[model samples]
Target: MEIFLQQLINGVTLGSIYGLIAIGYTMVFGIIGMVNFAHGDVFMVSTFIALIAFLALTQILGATSLPFCFIAVLIGAMVLTSLWSYMIERLAYRRLRGSFRLAPLISAIGMSIFLSNLVYVLQGPRNKSMPPLFNDVIQVTQGGGYDVTLSVKQILIVAVTALLLAGFWLLVQKTSLGRAQRACEQDSRMAALLGIDVDRTISLTFVIGAALAAVAGVLYMLYYGVVNSSDGFIPGVKAFTAAVLGGIGSLPGAVLGGLLIGLIETFWSAYFSSDYKDVAAFSILAVTLIFMPSGLFGRPDVEKV
Candidate 1:
Protein backbone atom coordinates (compact mmCIF):
# COMPACT_ATOMS: atom_id res chain seq x y z
CA MET A 1 0.00 0.00 0.00
CA GLU A 2 2.82 2.39 0.81
CA ILE A 3 4.59 1.56 -2.43
CA PHE A 4 1.35 2.04 -4.29
CA LEU A 5 0.82 5.44 -2.71
CA GLN A 6 4.32 6.61 -3.60
CA GLN A 7 4.01 5.41 -7.19
CA LEU A 8 0.65 7.13 -7.42
CA ILE A 9 2.16 10.50 -6.57
CA ASN A 10 4.98 10.04 -9.05
CA GLY A 11 2.56 8.88 -11.72
CA VAL A 12 0.28 11.86 -11.31
CA THR A 13 3.20 14.25 -11.57
CA LEU A 14 4.45 12.63 -14.77
CA GLY A 15 0.92 12.41 -16.09
CA SER A 16 0.38 16.12 -15.64
CA ILE A 17 3.25 16.79 -18.02
CA TYR A 18 1.90 14.31 -20.57
CA GLY A 19 -1.59 15.74 -20.23
CA LEU A 20 -0.42 19.22 -21.10
CA ILE A 21 1.36 17.97 -24.21
CA ALA A 22 -1.61 15.79 -25.14
CA ILE A 23 -3.86 18.83 -25.11
CA GLY A 24 -1.74 20.29 -27.91
CA TYR A 25 -2.17 17.13 -29.95
CA THR A 26 -5.94 16.99 -29.41
CA MET A 27 -6.48 20.67 -30.11
CA VAL A 28 -4.62 20.61 -33.43
CA PHE A 29 -6.42 17.44 -34.49
CA GLY A 30 -9.74 18.87 -33.41
CA ILE A 31 -9.30 22.01 -35.44
CA ILE A 32 -7.45 20.85 -38.57
CA GLY A 33 -7.61 17.08 -38.36
CA MET A 34 -3.82 16.77 -38.55
CA VAL A 35 -1.35 15.69 -35.91
CA ASN A 36 1.27 18.31 -35.39
CA PHE A 37 4.15 15.87 -35.35
CA ALA A 38 6.42 18.81 -34.68
CA HIS A 39 4.61 19.55 -31.42
CA GLY A 40 6.98 17.57 -29.26
CA ASP A 41 9.86 19.36 -30.86
CA VAL A 42 8.05 22.61 -30.24
CA PHE A 43 8.04 21.47 -26.64
CA MET A 44 11.73 20.68 -26.88
CA VAL A 45 12.35 24.13 -28.23
CA SER A 46 10.41 25.65 -25.38
CA THR A 47 12.58 23.84 -22.88
CA PHE A 48 15.69 25.23 -24.48
CA ILE A 49 14.09 28.62 -24.50
CA ALA A 50 13.29 28.23 -20.82
CA LEU A 51 16.81 27.08 -20.14
CA ILE A 52 18.20 30.16 -21.82
CA ALA A 53 15.76 32.38 -19.98
CA PHE A 54 16.69 30.83 -16.67
CA LEU A 55 20.38 31.29 -17.31
CA ALA A 56 19.82 34.88 -18.24
CA LEU A 57 17.77 35.42 -15.12
CA THR A 58 20.29 33.84 -12.77
CA GLN A 59 23.65 34.31 -14.45
CA ILE A 60 23.09 37.50 -16.35
CA LEU A 61 20.51 39.48 -14.40
CA GLY A 62 21.37 38.12 -10.94
CA ALA A 63 17.73 37.41 -10.03
CA THR A 64 17.26 35.95 -6.56
CA SER A 65 13.58 35.05 -6.45
CA LEU A 66 13.04 31.59 -7.87
CA PRO A 67 9.33 32.15 -8.22
CA PHE A 68 9.77 35.30 -10.27
CA CYS A 69 12.37 33.66 -12.48
CA PHE A 70 10.16 30.66 -13.09
CA ILE A 71 7.19 32.81 -14.03
CA ALA A 72 9.26 34.89 -16.42
CA VAL A 73 10.72 31.80 -18.03
CA LEU A 74 7.26 30.22 -18.39
CA ILE A 75 5.83 33.34 -20.03
CA GLY A 76 8.84 33.76 -22.27
CA ALA A 77 8.70 30.15 -23.41
CA MET A 78 4.97 30.35 -24.10
CA VAL A 79 5.18 33.54 -26.15
CA LEU A 80 8.20 32.47 -28.16
CA THR A 81 7.04 28.92 -28.71
CA SER A 82 3.63 30.16 -29.77
CA LEU A 83 5.35 32.38 -32.31
CA TRP A 84 7.41 29.45 -33.56
CA SER A 85 4.32 27.27 -33.99
CA TYR A 86 2.44 30.08 -35.71
CA MET A 87 5.27 30.33 -38.20
CA ILE A 88 5.31 26.57 -38.69
CA GLU A 89 1.58 26.61 -39.38
CA ARG A 90 2.04 29.35 -41.91
CA LEU A 91 5.13 27.99 -43.63
CA ALA A 92 4.70 24.25 -43.40
CA TYR A 93 1.04 23.46 -42.85
CA ARG A 94 -1.16 26.27 -44.13
CA ARG A 95 -0.50 25.78 -47.81
CA LEU A 96 -0.78 22.02 -47.48
CA ARG A 97 -4.22 22.32 -45.95
CA GLY A 98 -6.07 21.91 -49.25
CA SER A 99 -3.73 19.29 -50.62
CA PHE A 100 -4.06 15.54 -50.11
CA ARG A 101 -4.20 14.32 -46.51
CA LEU A 102 -0.84 12.62 -46.70
CA ALA A 103 0.76 15.83 -47.89
CA PRO A 104 0.26 17.59 -44.58
CA LEU A 105 1.29 14.47 -42.66
CA ILE A 106 4.47 14.11 -44.64
CA SER A 107 5.14 17.78 -44.19
CA ALA A 108 4.71 17.43 -40.45
CA ILE A 109 7.14 14.54 -40.35
CA GLY A 110 9.64 16.53 -42.32
CA MET A 111 9.19 19.44 -39.92
CA SER A 112 9.78 17.12 -37.00
CA ILE A 113 12.99 15.89 -38.52
CA PHE A 114 14.04 19.43 -39.30
CA LEU A 115 13.40 20.54 -35.73
CA SER A 116 15.24 17.64 -34.14
CA ASN A 117 18.26 18.06 -36.43
CA LEU A 118 18.22 21.82 -36.00
CA VAL A 119 18.29 21.52 -32.25
CA TYR A 120 20.98 18.88 -32.41
CA VAL A 121 23.13 21.06 -34.60
CA LEU A 122 22.65 24.12 -32.46
CA GLN A 123 22.41 22.74 -28.92
CA GLY A 124 24.50 19.60 -29.56
CA PRO A 125 23.40 16.06 -28.77
CA ARG A 126 24.23 16.27 -25.07
CA ASN A 127 21.74 16.51 -22.24
CA LYS A 128 21.36 19.94 -20.69
CA SER A 129 21.10 19.88 -16.90
CA MET A 130 19.77 22.46 -14.48
CA PRO A 131 20.01 23.00 -10.75
CA PRO A 132 17.03 21.32 -9.13
CA LEU A 133 14.35 23.40 -7.47
CA PHE A 134 11.38 22.79 -5.17
CA ASN A 135 12.96 19.83 -3.42
CA ASP A 136 10.87 20.08 -0.25
CA VAL A 137 8.52 17.19 0.50
CA ILE A 138 5.46 16.56 2.59
CA GLN A 139 5.19 13.25 4.45
CA VAL A 140 1.82 11.83 3.62
CA THR A 141 1.83 8.71 5.74
CA GLN A 142 4.06 6.29 7.60
CA GLY A 143 3.10 2.65 7.87
CA GLY A 144 4.19 -0.89 7.10
CA GLY A 145 7.85 0.14 7.46
CA TYR A 146 7.54 2.63 4.63
CA ASP A 147 7.05 6.38 4.32
CA VAL A 148 4.88 7.85 1.60
CA THR A 149 5.81 11.37 0.62
CA LEU A 150 4.77 14.11 -1.80
CA SER A 151 7.24 16.59 -3.19
CA VAL A 152 6.65 20.27 -3.72
CA LYS A 153 7.35 19.89 -7.42
CA GLN A 154 4.61 17.29 -7.65
CA ILE A 155 2.17 19.57 -5.95
CA LEU A 156 3.07 22.49 -8.20
CA ILE A 157 2.75 20.36 -11.34
CA VAL A 158 -0.68 19.07 -10.37
CA ALA A 159 -1.92 22.46 -9.23
CA VAL A 160 -0.72 24.24 -12.35
CA THR A 161 -2.18 21.57 -14.61
CA ALA A 162 -5.58 21.85 -12.94
CA LEU A 163 -5.59 25.63 -13.22
CA LEU A 164 -4.51 25.57 -16.86
CA LEU A 165 -7.13 22.99 -17.73
CA ALA A 166 -9.85 25.06 -16.09
CA GLY A 167 -8.77 28.18 -17.92
CA PHE A 168 -8.49 26.32 -21.22
CA TRP A 169 -11.92 24.77 -20.74
CA LEU A 170 -13.41 28.17 -20.12
CA LEU A 171 -11.61 29.51 -23.20
CA VAL A 172 -13.10 26.73 -25.30
CA GLN A 173 -16.60 26.85 -23.83
CA LYS A 174 -17.52 30.46 -23.02
CA THR A 175 -15.88 32.79 -25.47
CA SER A 176 -16.46 34.08 -29.02
CA LEU A 177 -13.12 32.61 -30.03
CA GLY A 178 -14.25 29.29 -28.66
CA ARG A 179 -17.43 29.52 -30.76
CA ALA A 180 -15.32 30.24 -33.81
CA GLN A 181 -13.07 27.30 -33.07
CA ARG A 182 -16.06 25.03 -32.66
CA ALA A 183 -17.54 26.28 -35.90
CA CYS A 184 -14.28 25.57 -37.70
CA GLU A 185 -14.06 22.11 -36.24
CA GLN A 186 -17.55 21.28 -37.49
CA ASP A 187 -17.08 22.66 -41.01
CA SER A 188 -14.34 24.98 -42.14
CA ARG A 189 -16.05 25.73 -45.40
CA MET A 190 -19.30 26.64 -43.71
CA ALA A 191 -17.46 28.62 -41.06
CA ALA A 192 -15.61 30.50 -43.76
CA LEU A 193 -18.81 31.14 -45.62
CA LEU A 194 -20.15 32.66 -42.44
CA GLY A 195 -17.16 35.06 -42.35
CA ILE A 196 -15.25 33.26 -39.63
CA ASP A 197 -11.77 33.57 -41.19
CA VAL A 198 -10.94 29.89 -41.12
CA ASP A 199 -7.25 30.58 -41.74
CA ARG A 200 -6.89 32.81 -38.68
CA THR A 201 -8.80 30.36 -36.52
CA ILE A 202 -6.55 27.53 -37.60
CA SER A 203 -3.45 29.62 -36.97
CA LEU A 204 -4.67 30.54 -33.51
CA THR A 205 -5.35 26.89 -32.83
CA PHE A 206 -1.74 26.06 -33.62
CA VAL A 207 -0.60 28.94 -31.46
CA ILE A 208 -2.72 27.77 -28.55
CA GLY A 209 -1.48 24.21 -28.88
CA ALA A 210 2.13 25.34 -28.93
CA ALA A 211 1.62 27.57 -25.92
CA LEU A 212 0.26 24.65 -23.88
CA ALA A 213 3.14 22.51 -25.08
CA ALA A 214 5.52 25.23 -23.87
CA VAL A 215 4.03 24.99 -20.39
CA ALA A 216 4.52 21.24 -20.48
CA GLY A 217 8.14 21.66 -21.54
CA VAL A 218 8.87 23.99 -18.65
CA LEU A 219 7.19 21.69 -16.15
CA TYR A 220 9.01 18.67 -17.53
CA MET A 221 12.37 20.36 -17.21
CA LEU A 222 11.56 21.34 -13.66
CA TYR A 223 10.58 17.79 -12.76
CA TYR A 224 13.38 15.91 -14.51
CA GLY A 225 16.19 18.49 -14.15
CA VAL A 226 17.63 17.52 -17.52
CA VAL A 227 16.69 17.75 -21.19
CA ASN A 228 18.16 16.92 -24.58
CA SER A 229 17.69 17.81 -28.21
CA SER A 230 16.23 14.38 -28.88
CA ASP A 231 13.97 14.54 -25.82
CA GLY A 232 10.91 15.45 -27.83
CA PHE A 233 10.40 12.21 -29.74
CA ILE A 234 9.52 9.81 -26.93
CA PRO A 235 7.33 12.18 -24.96
CA GLY A 236 5.71 13.44 -28.16
CA VAL A 237 4.92 9.89 -29.22
CA LYS A 238 3.54 9.07 -25.77
CA ALA A 239 1.39 12.17 -25.75
CA PHE A 240 0.21 11.29 -29.22
CA THR A 241 -0.71 7.89 -27.92
CA ALA A 242 -2.53 9.55 -25.07
CA ALA A 243 -4.40 11.74 -27.52
CA VAL A 244 -5.41 8.72 -29.55
CA LEU A 245 -6.28 6.60 -26.54
CA GLY A 246 -8.50 9.31 -25.09
CA GLY A 247 -10.10 10.03 -28.47
CA ILE A 248 -8.00 12.37 -30.53
CA GLY A 249 -10.62 15.05 -30.96
CA SER A 250 -11.77 15.17 -27.35
CA LEU A 251 -9.94 17.58 -25.03
CA PRO A 252 -10.93 16.08 -21.70
CA GLY A 253 -10.32 12.62 -23.11
CA ALA A 254 -6.77 13.58 -23.99
CA VAL A 255 -6.05 14.58 -20.38
CA LEU A 256 -7.66 11.42 -19.03
CA GLY A 257 -5.60 9.35 -21.39
CA GLY A 258 -2.44 11.12 -20.26
CA LEU A 259 -3.14 10.33 -16.62
CA LEU A 260 -3.78 6.70 -17.47
CA ILE A 261 -0.57 6.39 -19.44
CA GLY A 262 1.41 8.07 -16.67
CA LEU A 263 0.01 5.80 -13.99
CA ILE A 264 0.56 2.71 -16.09
CA GLU A 265 4.19 3.56 -16.75
CA THR A 266 4.92 4.43 -13.14
CA PHE A 267 3.28 1.33 -11.68
CA TRP A 268 4.77 -0.95 -14.27
CA SER A 269 8.22 0.29 -13.40
CA ALA A 270 7.50 -0.05 -9.70
CA TYR A 271 6.22 -3.64 -9.87
CA PHE A 272 7.40 -5.00 -13.21
CA SER A 273 10.59 -4.55 -15.19
CA SER A 274 11.47 -0.93 -15.80
CA ASP A 275 12.84 -1.83 -19.24
CA TYR A 276 9.31 -2.50 -20.51
CA LYS A 277 7.58 0.56 -19.14
CA ASP A 278 7.41 2.10 -22.60
CA VAL A 279 6.05 -1.15 -23.87
CA ALA A 280 3.36 -1.10 -21.21
CA ALA A 281 2.23 2.37 -22.23
CA PHE A 282 2.29 1.49 -25.93
CA SER A 283 0.35 -1.69 -25.23
CA ILE A 284 -2.47 0.39 -23.86
CA LEU A 285 -2.46 2.36 -27.09
CA ALA A 286 -2.55 -0.77 -29.19
CA VAL A 287 -5.37 -2.22 -27.13
CA THR A 288 -7.34 1.00 -27.34
CA LEU A 289 -6.91 1.06 -31.10
CA ILE A 290 -8.05 -2.51 -31.42
CA PHE A 291 -11.10 -2.40 -29.18
CA MET A 292 -12.10 1.23 -28.62
CA PRO A 293 -11.09 3.13 -31.70
CA SER A 294 -13.41 6.03 -30.94
CA GLY A 295 -11.82 6.27 -27.48
CA LEU A 296 -13.50 6.75 -24.10
CA PHE A 297 -15.03 10.14 -24.83
CA GLY A 298 -14.76 10.47 -28.58
CA ARG A 299 -17.73 10.34 -30.93
CA PRO A 300 -17.62 8.21 -34.04
CA ASP A 301 -17.57 9.99 -37.35
CA VAL A 302 -20.82 10.16 -39.32
CA GLU A 303 -20.36 10.26 -43.05
CA LYS A 304 -22.32 13.00 -44.81
CA VAL A 305 -24.35 11.80 -47.71
Candidate 2:
Protein backbone atom coordinates (compact mmCIF):
# COMPACT_ATOMS: atom_id res chain seq x y z
CA MET A 1 0.00 0.00 0.00
CA GLU A 2 2.85 2.37 0.83
CA ILE A 3 4.61 1.58 -2.44
CA PHE A 4 1.38 2.05 -4.35
CA LEU A 5 0.83 5.44 -2.77
CA GLN A 6 4.36 6.59 -3.47
CA GLN A 7 4.22 5.51 -7.08
CA LEU A 8 0.83 7.23 -7.44
CA ILE A 9 2.34 10.50 -6.33
CA ASN A 10 5.24 10.16 -8.72
CA GLY A 11 2.93 9.19 -11.54
CA VAL A 12 0.65 12.20 -11.14
CA THR A 13 3.59 14.58 -11.25
CA LEU A 14 5.03 13.01 -14.37
CA GLY A 15 1.60 12.80 -16.00
CA SER A 16 1.00 16.49 -15.46
CA ILE A 17 4.06 17.28 -17.50
CA TYR A 18 3.05 14.87 -20.22
CA GLY A 19 -0.48 16.30 -20.29
CA LEU A 20 0.85 19.82 -20.78
CA ILE A 21 2.86 18.72 -23.78
CA ALA A 22 0.01 16.57 -25.10
CA ILE A 23 -2.37 19.52 -25.04
CA GLY A 24 -0.13 21.19 -27.60
CA TYR A 25 -0.48 18.23 -29.92
CA THR A 26 -4.25 18.04 -29.49
CA MET A 27 -4.82 21.78 -29.88
CA VAL A 28 -2.85 21.99 -33.09
CA PHE A 29 -4.54 18.96 -34.52
CA GLY A 30 -7.86 20.26 -33.35
CA ILE A 31 -7.34 23.57 -35.09
CA ILE A 32 -5.49 22.71 -38.26
CA GLY A 33 -5.83 18.94 -38.56
CA MET A 34 -2.07 18.48 -38.63
CA VAL A 35 0.41 17.29 -36.09
CA ASN A 36 3.13 19.71 -35.12
CA PHE A 37 5.78 17.06 -34.91
CA ALA A 38 8.32 19.70 -33.92
CA HIS A 39 6.34 20.37 -30.74
CA GLY A 40 8.45 18.10 -28.57
CA ASP A 41 11.50 19.93 -29.83
CA VAL A 42 9.74 23.16 -28.90
CA PHE A 43 9.31 21.76 -25.40
CA MET A 44 13.01 20.92 -25.51
CA VAL A 45 13.81 24.46 -26.55
CA SER A 46 11.73 25.86 -23.68
CA THR A 47 13.86 23.93 -21.19
CA PHE A 48 16.92 25.61 -22.62
CA ILE A 49 15.18 28.94 -22.45
CA ALA A 50 14.16 28.28 -18.86
CA LEU A 51 17.69 27.23 -18.03
CA ILE A 52 19.12 30.39 -19.51
CA ALA A 53 16.51 32.59 -17.88
CA PHE A 54 17.07 31.00 -14.47
CA LEU A 55 20.81 31.40 -14.87
CA ALA A 56 20.42 35.00 -15.92
CA LEU A 57 18.25 35.61 -12.90
CA THR A 58 20.59 34.00 -10.38
CA GLN A 59 24.11 33.86 -11.73
CA ILE A 60 24.12 37.13 -13.62
CA LEU A 61 21.63 39.32 -11.78
CA GLY A 62 22.24 37.92 -8.28
CA ALA A 63 18.56 37.42 -7.61
CA THR A 64 17.87 35.31 -4.53
CA SER A 65 14.12 34.95 -4.21
CA LEU A 66 13.38 31.44 -5.42
CA PRO A 67 9.69 32.04 -6.04
CA PHE A 68 10.33 35.23 -7.96
CA CYS A 69 13.06 33.57 -10.01
CA PHE A 70 10.82 30.65 -10.91
CA ILE A 71 8.02 32.96 -11.99
CA ALA A 72 10.34 35.05 -14.12
CA VAL A 73 11.86 31.99 -15.74
CA LEU A 74 8.41 30.55 -16.53
CA ILE A 75 7.13 33.78 -18.06
CA GLY A 76 10.28 34.26 -20.12
CA ALA A 77 10.23 30.73 -21.41
CA MET A 78 6.51 30.93 -22.33
CA VAL A 79 6.88 34.23 -24.18
CA LEU A 80 9.97 33.18 -26.12
CA THR A 81 8.68 29.73 -26.87
CA SER A 82 5.39 31.23 -28.04
CA LEU A 83 7.34 33.49 -30.35
CA TRP A 84 9.28 30.55 -31.72
CA SER A 85 6.08 28.62 -32.34
CA TYR A 86 4.46 31.63 -33.93
CA MET A 87 7.31 31.99 -36.38
CA ILE A 88 7.19 28.31 -37.18
CA GLU A 89 3.49 28.63 -37.86
CA ARG A 90 3.98 31.68 -40.04
CA LEU A 91 7.11 30.79 -41.93
CA ALA A 92 7.18 27.02 -41.96
CA TYR A 93 3.53 26.03 -41.81
CA ARG A 94 1.42 28.91 -43.08
CA ARG A 95 2.57 28.76 -46.67
CA LEU A 96 2.38 25.01 -46.71
CA ARG A 97 -1.20 24.83 -45.45
CA GLY A 98 -2.65 24.65 -48.93
CA SER A 99 -0.14 22.14 -50.16
CA PHE A 100 -0.48 18.39 -50.03
CA ARG A 101 -0.94 16.90 -46.55
CA LEU A 102 2.32 15.02 -46.82
CA ALA A 103 4.13 18.29 -47.41
CA PRO A 104 3.25 19.61 -43.96
CA LEU A 105 4.08 16.32 -42.26
CA ILE A 106 7.43 16.22 -44.00
CA SER A 107 8.07 19.84 -43.11
CA ALA A 108 7.23 19.17 -39.49
CA ILE A 109 9.78 16.36 -39.41
CA GLY A 110 12.36 18.66 -40.97
CA MET A 111 11.66 21.36 -38.41
CA SER A 112 12.01 18.85 -35.60
CA ILE A 113 15.38 17.77 -36.94
CA PHE A 114 16.47 21.38 -37.38
CA LEU A 115 15.53 22.36 -33.85
CA SER A 116 17.24 19.32 -32.35
CA ASN A 117 20.41 19.89 -34.33
CA LEU A 118 20.36 23.61 -33.63
CA VAL A 119 20.17 22.93 -29.91
CA TYR A 120 22.85 20.29 -30.18
CA VAL A 121 25.12 22.79 -31.91
CA LEU A 122 24.38 25.70 -29.61
CA GLN A 123 24.15 23.91 -26.28
CA GLY A 124 26.41 21.03 -27.28
CA PRO A 125 25.66 17.39 -26.54
CA ARG A 126 26.38 17.62 -22.85
CA ASN A 127 23.56 17.22 -20.35
CA LYS A 128 22.63 20.53 -18.74
CA SER A 129 22.07 20.33 -14.98
CA MET A 130 20.44 22.86 -12.71
CA PRO A 131 20.95 23.49 -9.03
CA PRO A 132 18.21 21.63 -7.19
CA LEU A 133 15.54 23.92 -5.87
CA PHE A 134 12.71 22.01 -4.16
CA ASN A 135 14.19 19.05 -2.33
CA ASP A 136 11.93 19.10 0.72
CA VAL A 137 9.47 16.27 1.18
CA ILE A 138 6.30 15.87 3.22
CA GLN A 139 5.46 12.58 4.81
CA VAL A 140 1.96 11.59 3.75
CA THR A 141 1.77 8.36 5.72
CA GLN A 142 3.94 5.91 7.63
CA GLY A 143 3.03 2.30 8.22
CA GLY A 144 3.99 -1.31 7.52
CA GLY A 145 7.68 -0.49 7.71
CA TYR A 146 7.32 1.97 4.82
CA ASP A 147 6.65 5.64 4.41
CA VAL A 148 4.81 7.48 1.63
CA THR A 149 6.34 10.86 0.90
CA LEU A 150 5.58 13.72 -1.46
CA SER A 151 8.17 16.25 -2.57
CA VAL A 152 7.64 19.97 -2.79
CA LYS A 153 8.31 19.78 -6.50
CA GLN A 154 5.68 17.09 -6.94
CA ILE A 155 3.11 19.21 -5.17
CA LEU A 156 4.13 22.22 -7.20
CA ILE A 157 3.92 20.30 -10.46
CA VAL A 158 0.45 18.96 -9.67
CA ALA A 159 -0.78 22.28 -8.34
CA VAL A 160 0.54 24.28 -11.25
CA THR A 161 -0.96 21.80 -13.66
CA ALA A 162 -4.38 22.03 -12.06
CA LEU A 163 -4.28 25.81 -11.96
CA LEU A 164 -3.11 26.10 -15.53
CA LEU A 165 -5.69 23.63 -16.71
CA ALA A 166 -8.43 25.58 -14.98
CA GLY A 167 -7.29 28.83 -16.57
CA PHE A 168 -6.85 27.14 -19.92
CA TRP A 169 -10.23 25.48 -19.72
CA LEU A 170 -11.83 28.84 -19.02
CA LEU A 171 -9.93 30.41 -21.87
CA VAL A 172 -11.15 27.80 -24.28
CA GLN A 173 -14.71 27.57 -23.04
CA LYS A 174 -15.58 31.13 -22.04
CA THR A 175 -13.59 33.44 -24.30
CA SER A 176 -14.25 34.62 -27.85
CA LEU A 177 -10.92 33.14 -28.77
CA GLY A 178 -12.22 29.75 -27.79
CA ARG A 179 -15.28 30.20 -29.95
CA ALA A 180 -13.12 31.25 -32.87
CA GLN A 181 -10.92 28.22 -32.34
CA ARG A 182 -13.94 25.98 -32.33
CA ALA A 183 -15.16 27.58 -35.51
CA CYS A 184 -11.86 26.92 -37.22
CA GLU A 185 -11.84 23.39 -35.97
CA GLN A 186 -15.18 22.80 -37.56
CA ASP A 187 -14.23 24.33 -40.91
CA SER A 188 -11.54 26.89 -41.55
CA ARG A 189 -12.99 27.93 -44.89
CA MET A 190 -16.42 28.50 -43.41
CA ALA A 191 -14.94 30.36 -40.49
CA ALA A 192 -13.08 32.61 -42.92
CA LEU A 193 -16.33 33.26 -44.74
CA LEU A 194 -17.82 34.50 -41.47
CA GLY A 195 -15.14 37.27 -41.26
CA ILE A 196 -13.02 35.37 -38.75
CA ASP A 197 -9.32 35.60 -39.41
CA VAL A 198 -8.45 31.96 -39.85
CA ASP A 199 -4.74 32.58 -40.02
CA ARG A 200 -4.67 34.57 -36.79
CA THR A 201 -6.80 32.01 -35.00
CA ILE A 202 -4.54 29.18 -36.09
CA SER A 203 -1.46 31.15 -35.17
CA LEU A 204 -2.85 31.77 -31.70
CA THR A 205 -3.51 28.07 -31.33
CA PHE A 206 0.16 27.37 -31.97
CA VAL A 207 1.15 30.10 -29.55
CA ILE A 208 -1.10 28.76 -26.82
CA GLY A 209 0.14 25.27 -27.37
CA ALA A 210 3.76 26.38 -27.22
CA ALA A 211 3.16 28.30 -24.03
CA LEU A 212 1.76 25.15 -22.42
CA ALA A 213 4.72 23.17 -23.69
CA ALA A 214 7.02 25.77 -22.18
CA VAL A 215 5.37 25.29 -18.82
CA ALA A 216 5.80 21.55 -19.07
CA GLY A 217 9.42 22.02 -20.02
CA VAL A 218 10.15 24.22 -17.03
CA LEU A 219 8.38 21.91 -14.59
CA TYR A 220 10.14 18.92 -16.13
CA MET A 221 13.53 20.52 -15.61
CA LEU A 222 12.66 21.41 -12.04
CA TYR A 223 11.45 17.90 -11.36
CA TYR A 224 14.41 16.15 -12.97
CA GLY A 225 17.04 18.89 -12.37
CA VAL A 226 18.76 18.08 -15.63
CA VAL A 227 18.07 18.23 -19.38
CA ASN A 228 19.63 17.47 -22.73
CA SER A 229 18.90 18.39 -26.32
CA SER A 230 17.80 14.85 -26.96
CA ASP A 231 15.47 14.89 -23.97
CA GLY A 232 12.52 16.14 -26.05
CA PHE A 233 12.11 13.12 -28.28
CA ILE A 234 11.00 10.50 -25.78
CA PRO A 235 8.78 12.77 -23.73
CA GLY A 236 7.41 14.24 -26.91
CA VAL A 237 6.56 10.80 -28.23
CA LYS A 238 4.92 9.81 -24.98
CA ALA A 239 2.88 12.98 -24.95
CA PHE A 240 1.84 12.33 -28.51
CA THR A 241 0.74 8.89 -27.47
CA ALA A 242 -1.26 10.47 -24.68
CA ALA A 243 -2.87 12.84 -27.13
CA VAL A 244 -3.77 9.99 -29.42
CA LEU A 245 -4.96 7.76 -26.65
CA GLY A 246 -7.26 10.39 -25.26
CA GLY A 247 -8.51 11.40 -28.69
CA ILE A 248 -6.03 13.64 -30.42
CA GLY A 249 -8.31 16.57 -31.02
CA SER A 250 -9.89 16.63 -27.60
CA LEU A 251 -8.25 18.78 -24.96
CA PRO A 252 -9.70 17.11 -21.88
CA GLY A 253 -9.00 13.76 -23.44
CA ALA A 254 -5.34 14.67 -23.83
CA VAL A 255 -5.03 15.37 -20.13
CA LEU A 256 -6.78 12.16 -19.22
CA GLY A 257 -4.49 10.19 -21.49
CA GLY A 258 -1.43 11.83 -20.01
CA LEU A 259 -2.46 10.97 -16.47
CA LEU A 260 -3.13 7.40 -17.49
CA ILE A 261 0.22 7.13 -19.20
CA GLY A 262 2.04 8.60 -16.23
CA LEU A 263 0.33 6.22 -13.82
CA ILE A 264 1.03 3.30 -16.09
CA GLU A 265 4.71 4.16 -16.35
CA THR A 266 5.34 4.70 -12.65
CA PHE A 267 3.32 1.73 -11.49
CA TRP A 268 4.86 -0.49 -14.13
CA SER A 269 8.34 0.57 -13.17
CA ALA A 270 7.56 -0.05 -9.52
CA TYR A 271 5.90 -3.42 -9.91
CA PHE A 272 7.38 -4.69 -13.14
CA SER A 273 10.67 -4.21 -14.93
CA SER A 274 11.67 -0.61 -15.46
CA ASP A 275 12.88 -1.39 -18.96
CA TYR A 276 9.39 -2.17 -20.36
CA LYS A 277 7.68 0.96 -19.09
CA ASP A 278 7.94 2.65 -22.45
CA VAL A 279 6.69 -0.53 -24.03
CA ALA A 280 3.67 -0.49 -21.76
CA ALA A 281 2.78 3.11 -22.60
CA PHE A 282 3.22 2.61 -26.31
CA SER A 283 1.23 -0.57 -26.13
CA ILE A 284 -1.69 1.41 -24.79
CA LEU A 285 -1.39 3.63 -27.83
CA ALA A 286 -1.40 0.62 -30.15
CA VAL A 287 -4.35 -0.97 -28.45
CA THR A 288 -6.31 2.24 -28.46
CA LEU A 289 -5.64 2.79 -32.13
CA ILE A 290 -6.56 -0.73 -33.09
CA PHE A 291 -9.76 -1.02 -31.11
CA MET A 292 -10.90 2.57 -30.66
CA PRO A 293 -9.21 4.79 -33.20
CA SER A 294 -11.26 7.86 -32.35
CA GLY A 295 -10.00 7.74 -28.73
CA LEU A 296 -12.05 7.88 -25.56
CA PHE A 297 -13.53 11.32 -26.09
CA GLY A 298 -12.72 12.12 -29.68
CA ARG A 299 -15.51 12.42 -32.23
CA PRO A 300 -15.35 10.35 -35.34
CA ASP A 301 -14.24 12.27 -38.38
CA VAL A 302 -17.09 12.88 -40.81
CA GLU A 303 -16.39 13.02 -44.49
CA LYS A 304 -18.02 15.87 -46.35
CA VAL A 305 -19.75 15.14 -49.56
Write down the TM-score of every candidate. 0.98, 0.98
User: lDDT, candidate 2, residue 195?
Assistant: 92
Name the regions of candidate 2 deviating beyond 4 angstroms.
none
Candidate 2 — which pairs collide?
none
lDDT of each: 0.91, 0.94
* Candidate 1 wrongly placed segments (more than 4 Å): none
Q: For residues 22-116, could you state the per-residue lDDT of candidate 1 as single tens digits?
A: 99999899888898999989999999988989999999999999999989998999999999999999999999987988999899999999998
